[model samples]
Target: MKQIRLGLYQFGDRLIMRARHDWIVWTLVTAEGQARWREERRFPLTVTAAGIVRDLLAS
Candidate 1:
């Protein structure tokens, strides 16, 4: 199994979660940013927004 890691940070009022495999990056933003990501990016559903990102990257 490959190890998956998540990087977290806070910018302004939003929490950003990044899932990276090698050089590819999938960004998941939460709070107000999540709302915008859902609207504009059509984010997938999961237990949480961050979970969705984690799962996507793991796959």
Candidate 2:
């Protein structure tokens, strides 16, 4: 799951990610950049997307 999601931030100068599910929501922000929300159709995917959005928004 982490491997696939890594693609989303592959080009960024820096990345702040969130891991969803039973694990704690981890947010590490080093920059204040813009982030767009992506609505997902799959449950597992959506969890990841929303987590990313929250992580970015928190930045």
Candidate 3:
């Protein structure tokens, strides 16, 4: 189960956004920016190829 990050934006302190497949894993981290206490959301393989291309470009 491989998850890819599509996009992320900081809303003051917390990070949130969209992703897809394999699949996209959305993590809701502590507002203090700690990864220890976080929740994850799994999305199906529905994100567009362009999104992946954009991710690659950023990478």
Candidate 4:
């Protein structure tokens, strides 16, 4: 299983998602900027895109 950590920082109008896994980081910030939320859920990406969406929406 891959480990994922999500960090949300309040800027002006963007929800910044900083995710780190295995020393590699991926980031995405919402253009509208909303309150952030995060959780660790185990799912196979090959099985469904829902997991990807879920992680993003989880904030």
**Cα lDDT, all candidates:** 0.43, 0.44, 0.49, 0.43
Model 1 misses residue 19 by how many Å?
A: 19
Tell me how many clashing residue pairs each candidate has: 0, 0, 2, 0
- Candidate 3, residue 40: CA error in Å? 6.1
lDDT per residue, candidate 4, 1-59, as tens digits? 33334344444434233433312223334556444444444335534465567778888
Scored against the true structure, residue 58 in model 1 reaches a CA lDDT of: 92
Over 1-59, each residue of candidate 2 has an lDDT whose tens digit, in order, gives: 32225545434435345445524332323345554333222345435667667778889
Better of 1 and 3 by TM-score: 3
True-vs-predicted CA distance for residue 37, candidate 2, Å: 32
Clashing pairs in 3: 20-23, 20-24
What's the best-to-worst order under lDDT?
3, 2, 4, 1
Candidate 2: minimum summed lDDT over ten consecutive residues — where? 22-31
2 or 4: which has the higher TM-score? 2
Candidate 1 structure quality by residue, lDDT tens digits, 1-59: 22223344445434334433322233445556553231122233454556668889999
Clashing pairs in model 1, backbone N/Cα/C closer than 3 A? none
Question: Which one wins on lDDT?
Answer: 3
Q: Global CA lDDT of candidate 4, please? A: 0.43
Across 1-59, the per-residue lDDT of candidate 3 in tens digits comes to 42335343344445444454343444555567764323445543335565667777888
